[model samples]
Target chain A: MNLVLLFPILIPFATAVACLLAWKQRHVQRVLSITGAVLLQASGFLLLVSVWQSGIRAVQMGNWPAPFGITLVSDLFSAIMIVMAGLTGVTVLVYSLADMDTGRESFGYHPLMHILLMGVCGAFITGDVFNLYVWFEVMLIASFVLLGLGGEKAQLEGTVKYVTLNLMSSALFLAAVGIMYGAVGTLNMADLARHMGTVKQPGLVTTLATLFLLAFGIKAAIFPLFFWLPASYPTPPAPIAAIFAGLLTKVGIYALIRVFTLLFVQDLEYTHALLLVLAGLTMISGILGALVQNELRRILSFVLVSHIGFMIMGLGIFTHLAITASVFYIVHDVIVKTGLFLVGGVVRAERGTYEMSSLGGLYSSNPWLSALFLLPALSVGGIPPLSGFWGKLVLVKAGMETGQYLIVATALIVALLSLLVMMKMWADAFWRDSPGSAAGGSVVSANPVSFESRLVLFCPIGVLGLLTLAAGIFAEPVLTVCSRAADQLLNTEEYIRAVLGGIP
Target chain B: MEVVMSFVIGGLYASGLYLMMRRNILKLVLGIALLSHAANLLIFTMGRLTRGHPPLIPPGEVRVLESIADPLPEALILTAIVIGFGVQAFAIVLIRRCFETLGTDDLDEMRSTDRAP
Candidate 1:
């Protein structure tokens, strides 16, 4: 077993423990957390380099062979997600240092943050379906506490919705795993894929596919299941929301992509077609909902839900270019959504409100903030020459090739609406004159903000913003990596061979 | 055995979803617990039911001599139970805290986070 695969998960776990040990010293915890985050990023990049150079990497626990023992595997797709997780970890941790109140900080925020990161990285790397559920639970438990850490009424309220819905999804996911295990007599993903077709009941695979879809669908926040996200996301602090927005749902999409491409390929016509229909409805419902939201985070959350459809569309198309585009979209959305949330944090810090009605004059009072917000806002909203556009462009190309022009056209229309809505936000929040102190909403930043505090708060937003810009401008290289990752996904023999000794 | 377990699982799920639909938050948590238990049992039943043969290996034997109960489902169930216990315990405490803070048991009343001011 190559120990290199363990580094991404280990760094966060170690940092979390260190943070716990230095619990009383907030400064020490802060430094340890940042170092851990940076190390996580470095390790992820290192793994990506190795995977890119070699093929997929897999390791069995305790030197046990594949089918019986647990497997931790990373292909190009998983490695790229790890890199995104690490990047979001560093950015959100830095942002939290400034954005979080002392009450939450003193109450073990840093350790929980690292723990959440560890769980996310685990979900990305685990090759067993059951382990994925465990990782999701780890993430859920940590996030439950983090969401309700301060125990404020709104936080508790939001946590209730988040926790209940997520727990239900976990139950469904566990049940699916159990059934799949029973049907196939294996839990290793590669082995399951190998044996998925041989189940005695003819329709069992498709039924289980639907079960998996429903389970992951809730997590991914597709149309009907997305109500929890907007309700809960805006209730949390911006940094926490940033982390959740950037990574959590993307994990679900990753699972969907993983299983649909590998384990559930027997009935692509039914499952993939269903996915395409859901993608269209999801894109429409989510953006239309966003069109009416009055708060910054609420709007962004809706936008987040809508773009999930775009990724699902890629999976639905099930082509090399489409999956590549989907991967690129995931990469792009993670950074943009996180950055936009941090922008919300900064806006709240400066203007003391998230309600769009009361926000204005940011174009003059804080040009940097406006610029930072505009970069991600436009990127996610799919302006030309941006990261979002390249992903969308390739997705349209795939849709055209597959002759699924209706969904392609729907995607294009939704992209336009998203752009219009984002631009409306920019105009309402930054361009229009401030409604002044009288019209301000009740919610305000709990963190103390001063001119000097700008550096800490802006650091993550700036990093994420610049990353969005650079990822857009350098789309060629990233697209190459994504296409390779997509190829690995579509051709599962490579992944299976890496995990289960020899190819079956 | 599968027939009996099927009824049992169905009953648990039906009641769990029923409780989950109620307005009370405590019942909601209880429903979640019931739902997870049902899932655990489903896994147990699916692993196949064997009466007396335990998945034990005689000393130095390469493998089990009989078609023993598959230990994999039990192991998976144990892990799920532990995780479910942790989650449910935390959830109960959180619900209690919610009751204390909000001074209400109704889930609908806690709509401040859902609705924009």
Candidate 2:
């Protein structure tokens, strides 16, 4: 049963290798990518079911025993993340067949993408801290190449900033891991959590926790460390941007949640309090940044940063209910956020540019695209009456119960403010006629979009939109999984027993 | 000895950060290299400096008795060093390409991607 935990990681690794073998054949690579994604998605669901049935599953790789060896484990949280990664992985891989250019495709785009997928799966399931670091490097190297693949002017510019900042974070992450190992003598997360309270150095753990927060905060695009996000995310094409937008920061947030709930809980008063403050600031700053952007992708990028705060808000509150809400927020945000970016691509496909000033009459010309765009814009950013509402609602309720009314109020106000930004987007992009095409002529100045590409773009949006609605309308099942995942997180003994084995 | 190495590590980090803050892309890449080197050394020092013990154990023993120098951090640093080398290599090539295309080595002019569109 523990072997089932390896399937998510292995499938993508195998798929990526296959893609590399067919490097010269884009057609074969595309077919292989989709098949691999489907297999990955299937494996994710299987792993989730296995975890559901068996509680927590762990497998140790190579020769060492559990604590000293590299272990792969799946609890509810890891399984759910794998499943979500698979979902977006499939949609974006399918969407890329239409969206990515031939110039980019010739340069091993499919193989790098699968490697990225494998890295993500590896990050989600790894049970050791150093192993997690290695997986992160995998994701980073692939993303670095992907971000700079086409070597366009804007892309190179974006890649420079993106590379420098993320490398800083990676260095800090390494230092923190080293310090933790020095202090604890183990890199296994379960062992670290078990031994964290007994460290001889009095204030070292707090400092290490702060170091982790900084490292992951940069990755997750929290408040001060987030400029690289808006700087780079807009440079990539829609499908690439969508995958990065949907999945990348969430990995950082996942690490933050994992480390805080498990390894850093001893100093909650200092660490978690700081987290709460940062969450509020991230919410305010991100949306405020969005309000000034005229570009469709740029606006969506800022909104992505803003809503990342809501997920952190759940983690900051640090209660079972709050954690459950955070997990649900992650699921909702991943589906909705990826959909929003893909829709931005569609809007660009319809018009000539991503600039809202140049884009208009989309609703009148192509109402289907307009409606699909609305599904995500109106859904997340804590907007009411949609998939995003349940997460925020529970978050606010949890915050109120915890007597953290300031952050809760900030959360509520940010919700309304984000709604205002989304409305402004709708008015600017869909409601107004183009400045020149006000007389109802379509403003598709770019090359005529092919039917296959159109299908490629809209299908992902439709599927994500449906998933968003289903997550909203059928909130019970998702919420149950989230709540149980939260329970497993807050209570790590089962995880410890699974990974370390034969212990209380 | 640990204290002296700590200062050395601190100095490396300081210079690394100083270089990273420079406008020249070359300097920035150099800074990244310095920073990664500092991190690797920090890991090396933190693993506790025991000279020439050579983590090998005698055949009769089940384990290296009396606490042989921990070998894990060396392995960790090896991995980090390789990853860092790859990243720095990519960064150097990227700088060349950026210079060829963007026509500037200064980080300030690279703000076209960040400008309000």
Candidate 3:
């Protein structure tokens, strides 16, 4: 069980080292990455079982105990995150194998992918705030390399903006950490939660909380801080873009949830009200951006920002049910959003462009591709009997319970807008007719024998689609675990005792 | 001493914020550096300046403590300094590449490629 906690981190780190050593051998790197991702998925599942059985477990490094040393803790929340990350890691690795250009493969793309996975896993499991910062940097650096791997004109241009904005966020994060350390005298989250309770200065704590919120909010692509996401996410290759869209921003949300619930619950009225306003504005603005965009990938990227507001809204209400709903929504969004982006990638690869204005009739020429996209699209739009519907239902129920009428109303409106956006994508990309439809029809006829590429592409999307369905069908068990995870987060005494050996 | 350090940190942070808002990429990188330095100094000062103490007790002395300078803040500052150096290095390289490829450092000029022609 303990070893399971370490595998997600270690497997990727080992594979990253191997990939770097064999940098010149593209095939070797690909094979190794795929194998590592599979192993990581297995390990993640095993860790989930252990977490379910034993409750939250903590592993201290160098045997130095908790507050003074780095610790990796795995509760149900972190365990579930690892599994999702692993699943996405494998899907993206396979997609990249088929989708990445041969010339670009020679330039360490697989290595960076593995390193990014390492950072993702590390961030989920880390119990210390400083270690969280370290993992964030690790992930950002790898993303910077991956974003610029092709060195194309647009890639370079996007990389500059991405890197600059992320660097500023990182600076803010460091500044927050410094302030936190100065105030609390410890960096361990559990320890800080205890110390924060003792601090008498409300102004200082609120200031620090705001600083942390700004930093993580930028990463999470929440309102007013989401300008960089739509600008830069579309410039990367589809596989890279898909994973980033799926996972990276959620890391910030994860931190936000952890900090607000465990450490800063003293001022929930103020913080929750602020988050409510931000979430409302983010939802409206993001969907408007999506509606106005004609490009397929950029529209999807903006939709990602809008959907993020749903999760934030859930957290703002700050109920047990609401947090659970937020957790469920995040997991559902990660799978459905990434699957949609990969489908977009497939469309681009076939049509040689992502412009909705220039693409059409894919449904007639490639019914399987069209069908493949329909499941995730409908799921993301919160259709019933899908995972997305369950999350939205939970959140809406929680909102009504809490009497947050305005937030509930805004959420319903956004959900409708989301459906419209997905339908717009489906209509333009798959249903409408264009001048190149005739040429596309003939090209598919000529390529009647390339089932391997199609299989390779569809397998990952199929797995994700199935999981989305299964998660919806089996919402009972997943929700149970989420409820427990939320309970643990809200009950800070258990976490403190697990880390620091009983309250003084 | 505390007042002087506080002023220094404030000045650095103000300049850093100004630079960070500039259009030039190099200026942004420098701004991050200045901001980090200010943050580190602020953390150092928050430990509360105490003279004539080194945070170490003499060998086998039974509770002979004389208000040492807070060692934890020093350790935090060291770690923060190292992390800042790595991020700054990465930013410098990124800025150089941006200047070379974009042929301009002005952020406003880098318009969206997908904008309707």
Candidate 4:
């Protein structure tokens, strides 16, 4: 058992415990959180590098044999996901330093954030279906506390809806797990993957698959199951919102991809076709929702929901190229969405409101912020010379090759609509005259944003924007990594061997 | 015994879903609690019924010789129950706080976050 496989999960958990112990010392907790984030990034890189070199790695906890003991496994997909989680963790924590007030920090924000990261990492790495459930709960509980940290009336209202829906999701997830165990008599994911074809009742397997679809569909905010997301996501503080926008839903997508590709591919014609329908609906509904929203965060939240359809579309296609496109899209979406939300926070910080109707003149006053916003905004809209464009291009190309012209058309139209909405935001928030100010009030250059906060905030935004640009300009490496991960996913026997020690 | 347990589980799930559909927050919590219990029972039933024998394999033996019940589902149910309890407790406390602050337990009145003014 390699020790490195455990570090990505352990460091954040240890850091969370340390931060909790030092709760009274906010500065110490801040330093500890940042240090812990860096450590997490380093360890994630190490694991990624190792897994990239080696095919896949599995560690059986307590030395128990596989198919019996809880196993932590890392393939290229899981490792790359870990690395991305670490990246988001570092950026969001750094952003939180300036964006979050002392009120929330003293109330245990840093520790809960770390715990949340730990849970996300655990979910990415675990090899057991039941263990993934446990990690989901871990993420849920910590996220609950973080969401309602200051307990504002709006936050609490949002938290109630969030927690309610998520709890129902958990119950559904538990039910699926139980039924799966009864059907297969095992809880290990690799074991289940190997045994999926041989199950006595194929109908039972399909039922379990649908149960998982329901469970994860809610979490991923797909189509009809997405109302809880827009209701709650915009109520939290911006840094918290940014991280949630970045990681939470993607975790659900990760689970869906893992299972559908690895274990639940028995009846692809039925399951994948259902996913394609949901993908179209999700994309349409999400874009329409974004089009109507005037609030910057709300618009971005809907955009987040819409982009999930792109990844799901990839999954529905279920080809090697499609899965590769999905992985690339997931990477691009996580970075760009987080960056967009962070910029939204900056707008709110500068203007004291998220409603675009109340704000204006940002372009004349703060061209740099406008530029930062435009990078991710255009990227998310799938403009060329950005990371998001490549992901979309690959998915569309895959769709065309497979003769799924309708989905391809839907994707392109959604991309265009997304561009329109983003440009509308740009016009309203940056270019238009301030609502309260006179027509030519010179952009309200009163400097409401503090110098220190701007410096701290801009650092992460600039870094992430550059990373997005890098991912686009240097697409070959990222595409290589994604294709490798996709290849591993399509070939599940290697994973079963890695976990089960090649007994077959 | 198995048939009786199935009926009980079915009844719990029915009542649970009914309670969950209520607009009252307290009833919502009760519904969640009931549904969780039903889920636990459903898992319990899936393992089949064995009387007067535990799943213990004894001190020296590597496997149980007796036809004991499958223990994994029970273990899973136990974990699910603990998680359910935590979530339910949090839900109750949150509801109490919401009631005290907003002066309403009806889910309909809690649309402040959902509706746009």
Candidate achieving the largest lDDT: 1
- The digit string of per-residue lDDT tens for model 4 on A365-478 reads 789998999899899888887998999999999999999999999999999999998999999998886776675444453357778889999999998898889999999999
Task: Name the weakest run of 10 consecutive residues (lDDT summed) in model 2 chain A.
Answer: A436-445
State how far residue A484 of model 1 sits from its true place (Å): 0.4
Candidate 1 vs candidate 3: the lDDT winner is: 1
lDDT of 2 by residue, A1-504 (tens): 466788888888888899889889989988998999999999999999988887988888985688878989888999999999999899998888888889888888888888888899899999999999999999999999999998889999999999999999999999999999889988999999999998998999999999999999999999889989999999888888998999988999999999999899998899999999999999999989998998888888898999999999989999999999999999999999999998888777667689878877777877888889888878875555578989899999999999999999999988988899998999888888877676656465586778787888889899999888888889999999999999999998888998889854
lDDT of 1 by residue, A186-284 (tens): 999999989897998989999999999989999999878888898788888888989999998898999999999999999999999999999999999
lDDT of 4 at A384: 84
**On residues A249-358, what C-alpha lDDT tens digit does candidate 3 reach at each position?**
88988888888888888788788788888988898899989998989989998899999999898889999999999999989999998898899888887877888888
* lDDT preference between candidates 1 and 2, better one: 1
lDDT ranking from best to worst?
1, 4, 2, 3
What are the DockQ scores of the candidates, in order? 0.74, 0.81, 0.46, 0.66
Candidate 4, superposed: residue stretches over 4 Å from native: A439-447, B57-63
For each candidate, the alpha-carbon lDDT, in order, equals 0.91, 0.90, 0.85, 0.90
Instruction: Give, for candidate 4 chain A, the lowest lDDT window spanning 10 residues.
Output: A439-448
Interface Cα RMSD, each model: 1.3, 1.0, 2.4, 1.4
